[model samples]
Target chain A: MEIPYTISTRPDTGLWNAKIGIWLFLASEVMLFGGLFSAYIFLRIDAAPGTWPHGLLNVPVGTMNTAILIMSSVTVVLAWAALKMRRYRAYWWYMLVTILCGVIFLTVKLAYEWPQKFEHFGAYIKPEALWKYEKYLGNQRRAEKGLEPRIEITGHLHSENAKEYEVALDPVNAEPDSPAMDRPHFFPLPVTDKIATIEKEDVERATMFLPTHSAYFASYFTITGLHGLHVLGGVLVFTYMWLPVSKKLYQRNPEHLANRVEVSGLFWHFVDLIWIFVFPLFYLL
Target chain B: MSLKAFHIVFIIFSTLLALGTGAWCVWVDLVEGAPIYLAGAIASFAAAIVLIVYGVWFYRKMKRLRIIT
Candidate 1:
């Protein structure tokens, strides 16, 4: 049975069936993202001063991904326009580029950005020993480059008896299982000729700024992860449309093919729209 | 109203709302020196501009094809 109004507009709605359907779906998508965005605003406003993490995300990398998505949006629209003009080959090329852009965006997010966040460890230190730890880190940097350690602890270093000890941190390592695998042992700080071990007890808090780390991260992951899923969906749909099945439809009824591309393009643009908000909210702010 | 007219109007209104909100966020970021507001501002503003350009182009193309009067 053929579906009516697939190619032509209905009298009441003044839009084709698929067009109205996509608009309705996009309306719901707006509400979904709107709620998450509201949560982000509340979390940011309520966060304590100086507690929220900043300079955590790499701005240049985020900007690159933003550009990729924006370009994909244009290509998707052009793909639809190509189909409208009955240019099948041009449509295929534009859709291919759109899918490739989505692939690259996801690749950068999972391979680079997400892993970088997991590798960074934050340690909270006791108030009294903060200055000592700072001095030790400064001297450690100099000593690593073959300079003499300027600062020395002269007294009977109150080894294990002291309650207030400074938080010492380690730089992010390339090892896959590091920090996590070595959690039970002391946190190894880079000191000259000696492995300075910071026991877990002395450190007030130790954690990576993962989604579980704070409310800021919780909202960040939720919003962006959902947006990523939307991109993945577009990639799958466009891939299928570029295949032979859609070619068959193109030969039989080109208008049907064009309509499908238009619908998909609408969804694709909506995805790009969401990312426009997501990029700046997570990366810049 | 015609579908084309409705769509064009909707796009224009949405773009304006996005730009207004984005500008306000940027202003807040400048005053407060907060990262979140700045990020939101930039993204919203970019989205608005892209949609505006695309909407205008789509409208012109449709008119040329006699898809909308």
Candidate 2:
């Protein structure tokens, strides 16, 4: 079947074949994210509904990132528009703005959020400090639910058998009355009762002996860590492309530079779009 | 919007919807511990379908317009 518009051939012009190839590649990228999304769906289903809100994230921070990316998207589109008009100076300016936005986004991510999470990674902080943070989060969640916030208390002990036997954290298994299917058996706790009263100092020993109590912390790190890596990768790629444009290397070969920016823009957009999904999943939801 | 535009918007909107609903499922699972994963899966599947359709349509449109060689 013949396409309606015949391909244009101009010397050093951005070719249709290249554009098509890029689109095809982008489709595959969609599929790549599609797979991550599918895994997320399955895992989400496995989780008990309406119950997994980990309380450490700040929604406003994520929203700010979203706005930054959206604005960058606009700048790049203007850059492309300027290129179409062969307005090289405008192209450089808009593209530079886009690149600057990307840098700012990464800086905020690393400077603020990443360090905070790293501090909670149980690496440098004392056990008491870690416990305090966790309790603080739990209290924050309670407050959000309209309950008067009380001091976060860590009294729940990890079941000894919890290590040998894995409990299904999925809601299906969480049903108090569900037939114990694949239920991880836990060694009887030294402390009696489902809710154990724990002091800040004892929380470390208690949590180490039993880890599932801190599953939220694990999930928090995993999800945000994945996002941070993506931003880092984007920064490297954008920086490489950014230099050539900054020097007006593109003025000599507008189409080539345009093609490079187009490809990079596609990638940058994908990264931002993925974050759109990540923001709510990790922070708001 | 033209058919092509419609498809583009649909794909974008559906993707967003699926993500939103998926987050809701996560929230619900973490809180009420309800059986909402099935619903979330369905929504995401639908979104993926929309995206696939949009991809094919967009590719074809670009080809017709000679935007892609």
TM-score of chain A of each: 0.77, 0.59
Q: Individual DockQ of the candidates?
A: 0.08, 0.07
Runs of candidate 2 with Cα error greater than 4 angstroms are A1-17, A48-51, A121-223, A244-249, B1-69
Candidate 1 chain A: 10-residue stretch with minimal lDDT? A149-158
Docking model 2 quality class: incorrect
Report the C-alpha lDDT of model 1 over A155-249, residue by residue, as the tens digit: 11123334432222333211212323111111122312222444445466555657876687788778888999999999999999999899999
TM-score, chain B, each candidate:
0.86, 0.56
Interface RMSD of 1: 5.5
Candidate 1: regions farther than 4 A off: A126-197, B1-69
User: How do the residues A53-95 of candidate 2 rate in per-residue lDDT, one tens digit apiece?
Assistant: 3434554466567667756765665565566566777877887
* Clashes by residue pair, model 1: A280-B39, A285-B35, A285-B36
